[model samples]
Target: MKRALLILAATAVVSAPALADEALAKAKNCMACHSVDKKLVGPAYKDIAKKYAGDAKAADMLATKIQKGGSGVWGAIPMPANPQVNDAEAKKLAAWVLSLK
Candidate 1:
């Protein structure tokens, strides 16, 4: 019982930021084209994390891509520029996506 309680508490602590970032993503309309574990219009967050694993610059690159949008990386559909998401929110979303690995 004691161990279970501690584990649950730890899980909750770790989940809070993830949940918050997910909410942020949804609020920014990211979820319309992206999902965490599976491909949608865009690649899954997990896949992105896998591809960029061990990349020290992945977070910064992803943040810029999130705000300014990019094409050819994920193919022809293209991610539209997210003018509404500021740098901090974009960075937070990038960190969250990378953390899915």
Candidate 2:
């Protein structure tokens, strides 16, 4: 009983951030082209953060790019403009993606 309770408590703690990530990902349509561990059209979230590792401006740059849309950074496939994501949301999403590292 004690072990089961501990497990349940651990799951509850872990699920919060996972749920938050999923919520933001769904809201931003990130699941359409990206995943936490794998790639679809664009790079994986982990790969993106790795590529931009240690850069102070990564959050800002990524947020702008997410809104503006561009290509050739990762590959020929272009990330479409996401007018749906406002600046604040973009920052949140960008920071989340970068946190994948």
Candidate 3:
């Protein structure tokens, strides 16, 4: 019983950050255009992770894109720049998106 309880606690601890990051995404309105597995206005987070999977600079590039926005990569529908998301918040969001992989 104690071992089961310990496992539950460990799972919670691991899941908490992921939940928090998702919450952050929602708060930033990222969820309006993006989802975990399904494509919305933007590509799915998991797809982004898969596309950038072995990339050493994905996090940084994604962070920059998060803040500055980019186009022609995903499609013709250019992603407008997010002036609301600061640099640090952009980095965190990018990291979380990449973690979906």
- Candidate lDDT scores, in order, read 0.97, 0.88, 0.92
Tens-place lDDT digits, model 1, residues 11-30: 99999999999999999999
lDDT of 3: 0.92
lDDT of 2 by residue, 1-101 (tens): 99999999999997787679669878879789988888998999899999999999999999999899989999999999999989988898888888875
TM-score per candidate: 0.95, 0.83, 0.95
lDDT of 1 at 67: 98
Candidate 3 residue lDDT tens string, 1-101: 99999999999999998899899889989899999999999999999999998899999999999889899999988888888999888999989888886
- Per-model clash counts, in order, read 0, 0, 0
RMSD of 2: 1.9
Per-residue error for 79 in candidate 1, Å, reads 0.4
lDDT: worst 10-residue window of model 3: 92-101
Q: What is the lDDT of residue 33 in candidate 1?
A: 99
- Candidate 3 runs further than 4 Å off: none
